[model samples]
Target: MRSRLPRLLTPLVRAALSKRVLPRVAFSGAMSAQILGNRARSITTYTEGSDLPRVRPHVWPAPSKDIMAARDFIRESAASPKNILIVPDREPDGMASGTIVSLVLQLLGKPESEIRIHFTAAGFTIFNPLERARLSRVCQKENVSHVIVLGQGARASWSLLEKSIETKALIINDQHSDRFLENTVAVSASRDPPSTTSSLLTYIVCSELHPEARETTGWLALLGIFGDLGARASLEPPYPQELKDFKKKYTSTHLRDLVTLLNASRRTPECGTRDAWEILQYTPQTNPAPTPKSIMKGEANAELRERLKDAKTRVNAEVRRCSKMPPRFSKDRKVAIIFMDSPYLVHPLVATRWSNYFDPNLTKLVLAANTGYAEGKVSFSCRAVSGRARKGDKGGPKEYETESWDINVISILREYLAKDSLLEEQARGEFTNGYKRATGGSVPLDVWMLFLEKGLEITPRKGDFPQKHALDYIQD
Candidate 1:
């Protein structure tokens, strides 16, 4: 009943024992404790786990006011006598959020026919006029009575979306909500660096419908969490109980691999979000639900592996080609612009790749602009230079507030657009869009050129950024 770790154990042996890393028997269990004196006690399975205090099942704090409001809205809407239109962002987190909504609705007895999933066009957030018009039309004919917006756009965009669509009730769930709208809820892992993903927030709200809501869709929730938060979801604390439960069932690496494969469905040139959703959806909503393993191993679907390979292959080639482009910083050394003409949607990928190499203090953001990604539009992706808040830095993302330590690159772009007289007249799609911290814009040729020539105060040399000026912001 008593045990003590021998100080004589080497670090490697200690780590092996602590992590249970020594194969089937576990390092600690493989060795029986030896008693040396009257004070010493012998215990088999000398696990570091045994030395630690027992941890209780994590109980979440009572849902916040916003969470309660979202819960109420979903509860009321579930029994609504009309169609509910679900508009998900066109990426992994969005898809996972939409799927969670669909499953929870069915759990609340809402029929499948009443739930409709709408995918916005690529390179378009809800802020895009084209997508807004599409949503307005979808809400027309008085058929869609309830609306749930998931996994994209900040609260401002969500506010505008609510006014744009004429639904009886609307719920906005996002990771970047500055303030809660009428029916908006925001969540994150910890308040400082990473936010609770949109999909996980949806699961938390849906749990009010039934306790099984969390049990059934915990794995699905991690899809969105990992898709948005990346590996930080597993690393960060204030960890969600649902996420903890999922880790019990699957390895962090395996979940990550699953997220990559599923994300590939949408990121490829073809954009197979629907295909991804089909494989990811938890059918029948029962205890023996399908898991990430089923999708990875291609259970009942051999084509999954092939499709994943095709998507990854195309993305890898494009990323490799565009990642070679070097960054050009602004006069103040705040913004680092890297321009490449790629036909694939690799701007975000290359921007993120470049972010890994940046100095968090010197480079505020890395903007990867792809002129060839969209026809006649210069699509750009923005990434914050990696850094964490120190003491007294979490007040705001502005230079003065955070010492530009954790820059709000989104605000910088938005401020430029708002102050510049040239961009004031530009339409929504022709300028800035996306989230608060992770924002980017699609600029037409004229605007793109003006931005390149005058905005950053950098002259685009043919050697530095070939097509930026040569093609007049168009990539031949």
Candidate 2:
């Protein structure tokens, strides 16, 4: 069912494409009614030459003191002789946001040798003990002076890591609901609609660092938005003005294709992320930059092309196998949980698929967990559907315009996991830290098992389970 979603919604997307605009996709079945009934009014998405409701006029807010400080810090650090280490999660949004900072520094006269980038592996964050060890090595060897984190969580200070890795200044750019490091310079999009993503958020601040940044980095910002949000970026809107100008600059197909390619870069746990950074970079003089198609067909990128093909095969297979496992509900029916064990990174895809299957009012949350993604740890993804479409609504899914249930998912996870006796002896690092609705952790498998026993009802695997439900997808 997860693998079939794009096919189910493709026509609506094509209809949206025909008009050279983002799709005003309508969920036409019971999904049209329940998952998003008009519970709360919010920003809207529009279609040209059609009666699709227009997005609310967004009043741009002034940059905050944190953003100004971050802006000033980057300018000052970019000129220093000491090296700067950039830490970003491997997701498309993180990569895009990291890319934006890299470009800004280069423009600000920061040399290539002075900058270092490390893409945290699948199911990991910089705060992870293993990741900290690796980053600390880089810092010690390079004489690092500062650390700039984009779209990932962190502690307020670097005191936890080896003393040598702590830089003179620490800056973070994020929009997640997790408890960010206190007493730090940071830029946050929490005040914006939940939709404002990392790359878009980073561009908002980095544009302040240099004059040419706005002109040179629009494409990257768009890529970042599409990368993180995927088709949802098109299906939902009141897209922040941060992305308004860039949206019109590129064709939706081109942007979508670019997103597919960019996301493919780090889909697998063993896949190296630097290639993605290299692939996403804006070539100095190429007119309009290298395209996904050109790069795929280009002789120089055969390895990347093969990498994408392999990732697509692995992800689609995992999506079909795990999406049908069936979910167990928390007694209150507020959370629907499914368990999977896959080496490939496909939990989010499976979770998003299941999120569309349950009744919204009954099951407000969907969590898909992969117990085999990493050793001794499980990675999970969480998603929510807003509310049912209201009376006489026909243009789009009510979810695109309705706000999610008021209880934040991250808050719930933190509330429970932080105090659970199951994790008292363990580090419990980044347990409840993640973007607003997409919450999960690379936690000890036992921690997840404990959460299941306490928070959800568990059932044994069916002996005659439909594990081969996706055998045919191998040929797809």
Candidate 3:
């Protein structure tokens, strides 16, 4: 018999049908599933979702109107394009590549002959001369006419594209506030408050594109969104609800696992944009067969999923090692800093994992540094523990102040960077957001350690970032 509860008494009836009465029902499992389904529907149906509480890793809120504006921008941009090249920063980042894949899928209807991709180096790092040469040559060989930059395009890339002179159009679809030109087609949640690049891009493409394109591309955008905003999104109202709806359509765990796998695959020193692109190509499809070598060859191995699992195990082991060691406490005793002697490639990942292991009751902030003596630089990653009690939280948090401030760890590191003359105060955009609470970047290793040992009172040279860091010194 079908189970039916009276509509008027639904709330009271469900409440009364508690654990005591649950097992007594003939269709207990079905009843439980139905209740859960109803609850899920209610979460999306809540009137004017702004009344809903914010959750953490700090989702910056964007208004629904702005989300629609960004959507319209992308839809209009994608409507017409020929010989398109997806230019993302060459850094080994999952979100960066996720954006690339999202766009590729949006343009999937276009002939393969028309779509091409190039990954550019990040802004802070000096581009490899050979890689720059390769990029120029790739653009010419592919006869790229329209370029869609996924992240903030490095100045070096912009200059190279200009020099090539064949590109007639450029589109900036990034999350950052960087506006290369007044006409750059970039819509940023950061630039446009409360919307992340991933959220904006996902909303735009899904709402505008064909159903087939939306089905293929929508999940990749969510992966990118999780990569930037963490599992709990901080996007504006309808977007967050949109994310929840998307998650419900599939196994959320698979999306999370794909994000982890992308990070693990990109963790190695050998990985770059090409590997990221290959990984992106493989991520959207659900094939029972082994990962095809044709999809991802060379650094993009077919066994990457297994390899990522192994990497997580190793990273977890290292976190345990760091936990056993006595951390360097800040003078206030609020921050715990750990310095790792691990290889350059593993530092950020190790630091990120280690940050998750902190005793929140004891430490408010966690900083992890991996130094490269040979490269003469130290890469640092910092985080704020979510469990730490905030100053005003004695009674409890207010509606907006749901999570702790992201701790301004980026600004803290930047102060030392500026004090040492390695970076100017305005150059804070160099670091990538692995998570909202997590930020890290390479500073002059020798100069940073001096400030770490001595106070910022020490003066260093102006513009002395080493052309190559310790990561460059390592041989395969």
Candidate 4:
């Protein structure tokens, strides 16, 4: 029976192969053993349960013309003495902006010395004195005469605008949502015009790409889509043929990594800004492939990675310590609040690690950090979580119940003040007896408090507030 089956089906199989319409076949165990004859071992058959449809050809659209346009835009921006601000909603998004900024600067022949990059906090409240001082110092050191605000609502702070009337400022309105755009435009129009004669320009760069453009040029558009759209699965309009092709060739992870590297430079000052500038300069061009050895040997990559590793370790240690302590809300359960100082760009990792150990259902993660410099004020990042919501099945949880492992450290420190008498005394000038403090003595405290109130909104429950002078550590 087996031998006869092959004889009967040979002609049909060959005809189907020629027409590219081979019919699906199924075979049971040991029934038609001789059907394949001498080639039996080479020919395998699928059963009904098999998933043959999973096989797919790699199809990507060709590179688009818009890439070139994007490159040209960057080149033009870089050439002019303008400060470029790239703001993404998250660290990865911010990193993508950094990459775009770096590429544009390089293309415009502007050296690292002439470029300045800034990121806005998650909530857009810049009120930290330390951050303010740092921005002031950077402005002075770089002799930056212009500012470009990227992301949805980033704009030159009134203070920064007032400092030097000669500074030029531009805003790149990448937030495509009409609602967000309207809010941003209104905010900009309401602010007082800068004392400087430099002009402010706003541009709308969407996700769709234009064909005939270079890959480097199209990054911002793609990035805007990925970042602002919350990594939606569907592609957006203005979909150039080339962009579709690029998407097929590159996985989302690849694009994400590129953005992360760029952001790492800005988030980690210890890594040195020049290193980020270098990575951005090399990434956009069709340059030699970057090797692990090359990245390790590169001063910027090395410094950035080292600092990141150290910061991660520190955060892990803090989380562990907090976990061991009795829960502030419940004694028998696990309670933790992870805080990140500045936008260290490692909040997600830290949060994930903490969530794994403690029941994400029982654990509360808070992410906080600095966003950008606004009118001599430092912006902050803050988020909170609740144990009950973690265990719930709701698809989208409430804001207060959601955890932000990246809660700004500045904000956490401020919350500590609200709950601890020692911190409040220090803030109220009761700690030191009649002695004059330095210029920014309580600046840190103020920054921390603002982060807690504005960023996290973690108000104490009834009787949760600390008692007056309850803490014995209060110094005179």
| Leading candidate by lDDT | 1
Model 1 residue 27 lDDT?
Answer: 21
The superposed Cα distance between candidate 2 and the true structure at residue 107, in angstroms, equals 1.5
Q: Which residue pairs does candidate 1 place in steric collision? A: 188-195, 188-196, 189-196
Clashing pairs in 3: 59-234, 60-194, 61-194, 62-194, 90-120, 189-195, 375-470, 377-445, 378-445
lDDT (tens digit, per residue) of candidate 3 on 136-215: 57767776655555544333134434354555333334334433433334444432223345434544534454544554
Query: Per-residue lDDT for 352 in model 2?
Result: 77
Worst 10 residues of 2 by lDDT: 32-41
Question: How do the residues 1-476 of candidate 4 rate in per-residue lDDT, one tens digit apiece?
Answer: 43576786786456434533323233311122222222222222345798554422211111123233443455555666645443222333334455555554555466655565654332332223344455455555656554444433322334433343444443443311122211122112111101000001111132222222245545444443443333333442213435456555555665544444444444443434444444434443445534223444454366655654444455445445433322232222323434333323343334333343343344433332222212222232222332233333666433233333332333433444565554465452211111010001112434444324433345323222122321221222
Candidate 1: C-alpha RMSD to true structure equals 12.8
Candidate 4 stretches with Cα past 4 Å from truth are: 1-90, 105-143, 151-157, 173-214, 219-244, 256-277, 283-286, 289-476
lDDT of each: 0.63, 0.62, 0.47, 0.37
For candidate 1, write residues 102-148 as lDDT tens digits.
88888888888788777777767665667767776777754887778
TM-scores of all candidate predictions against the true structure:
0.73, 0.73, 0.60, 0.43
**What 10-residue stretch in candidate 1 is worst by lDDT?**
32-41
lDDT of 2: 0.62
